[model samples]
Target: MATAVVGGRLESELVRDGSDRTKGLSRRTVLGTIAWSSLLSACTSPMTSSGETPAANALATPAAGQTLGSGSVRIALIIPASANGNAGAIATGLRNAADLALREFKGADLQILIKDDRGTPEGARAAAGEAIQEGARLILGPLFAPSVSAAAGVARPAGVPIIAFSTDTSVAERGVYLLSFLPQSDVERIVSFAGMRGRHAIAALLPANGYGTVVEAALQKYASASNSRVITIQRYQLDRVSMQVQAEAILPVLQRKEADTLLLPDAGDAAPFLAQYLASKNIRQGDIQILGSGQWDDPRILAEPALRGAWYPGPDRAAYSAFAARYQAAFGAPPVRTASLGYDAVSLAAGLAARYGQQAFTAQTIANPNGFLGVDGAFRFLPDGINQRGLAVYEVGTGTATQIDPAPRTFSRTM
Candidate 1:
């Protein structure tokens, strides 16, 4: 159910006119990011004393000692508040998660200061400045990639650490940590799974974009490390006109039987079309095993006959279901997948309060080898500031997917 970025100049033109098509694309992108969040939120069991998951309290009662201790930690939560869009909804989920953490850790002296980024790079910088002025020690969010980059420029100079929510890895650096689901992690998981199953000759049909470049590199890296070879790597312009041509190009490689697995890292909607196109050329799923990223979790993808038995790595649904139930009960609606990120970030800070004092986002603690359990299983930040997630493998079936390998509860295999 992932909505990919509309291709190049066409998308830019649509944005200028505010066309209905662009609006629809925007909605789909937001939905994709939300679906993206489920992969991040699919973690271990609740971390509450009563064994019940933390939810928004009905009384709205303030926790004991709201203004206690001389050393109070102010965490700035920056998100797009003015825009009644995805970021705004995500911000609400973040606030709820922060509030839940505050209640869960009553003794911790912490305060969350919410700021609106206005969904612009300049706005992000302004928000970061405001957070610094308000004496924030750590910052969370400003979702878009440009905003994350702009916000980081402000936070880095002031020696403040940021737990940004953007999926773009380019923004990650020393003081800025990415808590978003990365395509690299998705590739590594699925590739490693394929390698273990003795299906190593890989062929990729990747989108012609930065994200595609990352996954392409990942496929090469994993293939090389596993003593396997990449048979063919085909790049495609993600448009209707270019799609047929791209599918046609792959027909030769499929006909030659150069690879055991075919990687199609496109949206679920595109899967059926690609499958059918290839099938029409006598290149069916029976010819080669289909592999995909976490974005292929949509049920609609399973309905396509051509994609039956396709394998992709995704978040643990059982874990996500539990978290979603609690979120829906508290917020009166289900949260998008990424709501767990805000909850996890604040919860991490609160959990570290005992060991790291008011400022708990130090590099040493943040890069703990053991990693921490969040809504999205076990995750830990690498030294480079990119976070790695524990993911599971699933095989697409009729109307649904069945989990084949559960996500690791620890980072033993991950590290």
Candidate 2:
């Protein structure tokens, strides 16, 4: 069941002087008295997080001599320390969202603490401890699976819950909850859509990496469950030479009528190269529909003429125009995948906190079945803490992304 909290009431008191005012007090005396009165008033007034009046559900004011200023609530944001990686971008996005949330709840007196894990397990553990020592009640991230594992050891015992950004479901346990966009879900959606379109036989050109391996496994599992056939699966190193060799090797398979669908698990950066190779083989877009992961949202993919009609699953950008505009105004660039995810994560946490108070940081709260609505769309947490997203499918056309598939709905058993 979801947890709930009650908001505290504000009280006002007036102070009076015992002395008679038959003769008006001197200017100096009046000034001194006013200064002291103002100070006393400030001391008695309740403190707030965002500097606004408290909401109906705001936490009660702490007793006298307790932690000053509405009892500090710290949130640790553990992310890669590097400033140039995807993880880094996600971290920045989370921070930005948190800042916005804090601004909205100024009266709550919420304190958001941040820590960098440098994308290492050891660093994550150290950062988690530091946040605890600094009195953090909740943790926001450790963007990698290994980092989540390392931080979980420290956070679980303290009863501090974590909203991690790791994609690996295995890392979720105890008080840790994942807030990532799992590639498996994206693949499943793509495959199911392809199957519905009567494109059964499948082939893949994936990188020889952990992500690639996961995609391969997911494809096999979905194909079996969906009663589809996998005609060929090709692996390629990310380097130029290996990509060329792998493309050439797959050309023969592409010639087969059975291999009517091709899945590329790589991101947008690799699209142009793959498109060039596919064009050389005279494989037009409509002849064999190309399926891709959400990573294809990168603008670079649109530059490739051969990528037209290429389909991939991703969040609906049209629904978040305000967020996109504000983000661009602040960061001087449009929102990318990382930025959108980050905004959603922060908004989710803020909503949870507003609802649950102390219970907001609990594992059960993070994994609440109802889940949280985000800027991207509605998403729910599985038992393992990975977010089950309902993503939208888009097609590349004329150097732009166009929505082709209908918006996803909550998966009901009856459906």
lDDT for each residue of candidate 1 in 1-415, tens digit (9 for 90 to 100): 1121222112122224332110000001000012122222222332343446645443122121122123377878787666443545555666665554454444546677777776678888998998898788888886777888889999998988898877767778878888877888888888888888888888888878766777888889878876678998878776756778888877787889988889987764676778878888888786798998887766567788888888988766654566565555665566556666776787676556545684467887777766776666667888788888778898888977888888875677742
What is the C-alpha lDDT profile of model 2 across 271-362, one tens digit per residue?
Answer: 57876788888976788889888767666776678888888877666546555544444444444444445555555555555556777666
Best by TM-score: 1
Q: Model 2 residue 381 lDDT?
A: 70
C-alpha RMSD in Å of predicted model 1 compared with the true structure: 7.4
> Candidate 2: global Cα-lDDT?
0.61
Report residue 294 deviation for candidate 2 (angstroms).
Answer: 1.0
In terms of lDDT, the best-performing candidate is: 1
TM-scores of the models, in the given order?
Answer: 0.82, 0.74
Instruction: Tell how far residue 372 is off in model 1, in angstroms.
Output: 1.3
For residue 17, what is the lDDT in candidate 1?
38
Q: Which runs of model 2 end up more than 4 angstroms from their true locations?
A: 1-73, 80-90, 105-109, 168-170, 328-337, 413-415
Worst 10 contiguous positions by lDDT, candidate 1: 22-31
